[model samples]
Target: MLYGNRSTMSALSRMTEGNRLAQCFLFYGDKGLGKKTLAKWFAQRLLCSGTGEKPCGVCKNCRTVQKNVHPDVIWVPHSGKLQGFSVETVRDICSQAIVAPNSGDKKLYIFADCDRMDTRAQNILLKIIEEPPAFTYFIFTAGSRQTLLPTVISRLVPFAVSACTEDETLTALRELGWPDADAQEAVAAFHGNIGCCISFLEDDNVKLLVSLTKEVVRCIIDKREYDLLKVFFSVSNDRNSALWLLHDLEMVFRDAVTFRLGQDIPSISCDPVGAGMLAGKLSTAKGQYFHKCIGKAHDAIAANVNLQLVMSALCAELMSGK
Candidate 1:
């Protein structure tokens, strides 16, 4: 059961109830936004056999789907160093789509994290996606709809998933048996990103990133160029960690810009005091310039640029202030 984004859930229910659900569906959102979970729930609703609710959870079909043992439901996982599906994998899925359903009335293929899918792979899926068989359905979850090509986007129904309110997130975490202090700490660090909040509590890597993000923000605020570079160097070998750190730092810069404008913004900054200090130290233009540099660094990282070099250059860019 999802706690937030009732609008998207309602839209899914309407599509299912109205018998207007499209052959291809896209659920797009940032990491930890539960696109894949929503995809699973939608799958349950579509394949449920019980008499009451669409996904009468007690039914054998619903139970099998919940346990991921449903014969007619296929979960496509990524398979590469970059965690992307290859052209061959896409072709295999296309071939499998022509087969008859194994058990249920419909055959559903779910592709999670479609953001990492290469364009060639997406092209391979075009034919099946545009005109799938009567008994076939395709579902994809991505960090952003822009990750897919326009042709692919044109053939699919897209749903944008969003995080819950902070209050709601806090409540949900507590209901998960987290203590009040733990819940409040997670909420402060990650706001409504329930997955990330859970990660923050359980994953030491996440805790390190949070600390590093705060450290990076403080270094920027104090104009400590070398220290900034040094902090980034610690996580230089881990690409995902680097990206996560950059995103959190970007959030801090965003809050700083918001603070400069005298606007009250709900911030997910790990270092709110540093954000306020940055708001005083840098002009809006300068703040924005750093923010854009972060974007450049993000792209560089995504393109597989040398992480240490990228960090060094980003440190220089942030300190240059021109």
Candidate 2:
């Protein structure tokens, strides 16, 4: 039952003590901030049949849910390929929500990545949230509240989750048995996102991220045209990782910009020496150009435009001038 940031744990514990069961709760935060994990924890508590403090993980209901074999708990995953929740998915959840729990006291429906729910799907969801079944409870997670329908957000109690502090992040990484140095670097790479830090520790993807960042800085300063597609392929082989890589690239460039603007060099996200070197090479005007290019890249990403075109434009700007 224990997961996520201390603040969120405190809030949930306080609410549990008050015995207030909210029909819906809006959990919003940056990626890797444990919103999904916290949602699962909340759902477990609601489904627990224990006598006290609810999520007695020992309870039969809690055990079934923990093993993901509970008939009463319905989990709807947002389809990453489609890039949004489908109407059918929403309808399915609605149908399941009305049914009484087969074993637990409440029927728990978890909508992961609710931000991916399109307008139509969101509207359908709003109707359900407005009048949830008496014994139903809902847990939804999103990257931002703006991605949700306004009506859906208005009816839900909101919880803002964020990355844990530096110490807590390190502790979480160590709990995963990550090496001290690797843990430190992962924390820096993820900007303290606990989930990302854990992933970086367990995966080979972080190596590509570090390599890509170094290449990007090299290409930026060389002011030479390079195979942008090759770089993209080398770093991001999938849509999900592509999004993370794009965001990480933006942050790397932002650190360079910060260093160029005469900020603390150690404050940069990448290797300090590399950051300072990149900063030293970037003139003020070029720094501004890079920053502008990053903004455009972000817009292209959000619009679901061609990633190649966005990368090409960014490369053109990045290689423009000394």
Candidate 3:
């Protein structure tokens, strides 16, 4: 019972009625908006010998297709680090599309991350896409259709997968065993990307944040010196998203500090342990001091200050015996 976009499901249902289940479709959307999920589901439907709309999810062909072992269904990832389909890959795909299906009515090829494709590879794709085999279905996914060539664009039916509404996103999270408060925070933190929310939930860094934030707050309350540079360097993964992770960490810490000092903790961190740990370390003056340092640290980090220096200053400011 995987979730699906309601709008997309309706449009697809209409397409099934219109008999425009063309040989090719271009699915466009932001990352983690379930383009690949829907593509795979559609592939299963096409491969199924079932009587109705959905693949029976029980037939031999459907099971194999769901497990990604179907001979007639090919899933191609962007070949390069920057995320684009390769010319060689496109040629390979075309070669496969022409072959008859081993056990189904159609041979389905899904190209993920088509936005990374260069002009040459796209041109290669455009040729076969212009006159695809009657039994072949080519589904390409891109971040946006603007990245695709007009020639390629005109050959396929475009399917736009939009981000789910906040309520829909929250409901999905709640179904994943998250409490209402935690689900709300995860929705905001991941901007409604279920995969990213799951990533955050499973992150080792979050586990560390639970303990480390408590220890840092204890130091602040008891007036002991702590080193920020070591913590900062340990947390940042040498990527652009590192900053985002840091911001999220700081929010959790602030919530914990408030909870520790008998203040209402903002229900913004998904980790319950983190909230409880901070709650155990309450002191009025200490909480205020720590909150001020958090603001300063965020400002320094945002200004692109040297990471080590920012960490050092932040640690010194928050630690009591410094």
TM-score of each: 0.95, 0.83, 0.63
**Candidate 1: residue 158 lDDT (0-100):** 94
What is the C-alpha local distance difference test score of candidate 2?
0.71
**Residue 71 displacement (Å), model 3:** 1.4
| Model 3 spans > 4 angstroms off | 1-4, 16-21, 204-322
- Provide the lDDT at 218 for model 1: 79
Model 3 RMSD vs true structure: 9.3
Candidate with the greatest lDDT versus the true structure: 1
Summarize candidate 1's per-residue lDDT along 1-322 as a digit string, tens digits: 5678888887788777656567789999878878877888888888898898687888888888888989888898688767889888889999999999988768899999887788899998999988899889889998889888999999999999998999999998998899999989988888888888888888889888989988888788788988988898998999999998988888788889999998977776666777889999999999999989997897688667899999989989888888
lDDT against the true structure, each candidate: 0.86, 0.71, 0.67
| lDDT at residue 316 of model 2 (Cα atoms) | 66
Candidate 1 has a TM-score of: 0.95
> 1-322, model 3: which lDDT tens digit per residue?
3465767766665554445456788899755678888887777777777776566888777888888999888888666545567788878887877888887667888887776578898887877888888788888888689878998899989988866666777888888788888776667655556755655566756445544554544454455564444555665544334344445556566666667655763345444455466556645455556666776676466445676676666666666422
How many residue pairs clash in each candidate at the backbone level? 0, 0, 8
lDDT score for residue 57 of model 3: 86
For candidate 1, what is the total of clashing residue pairs? Answer: 0
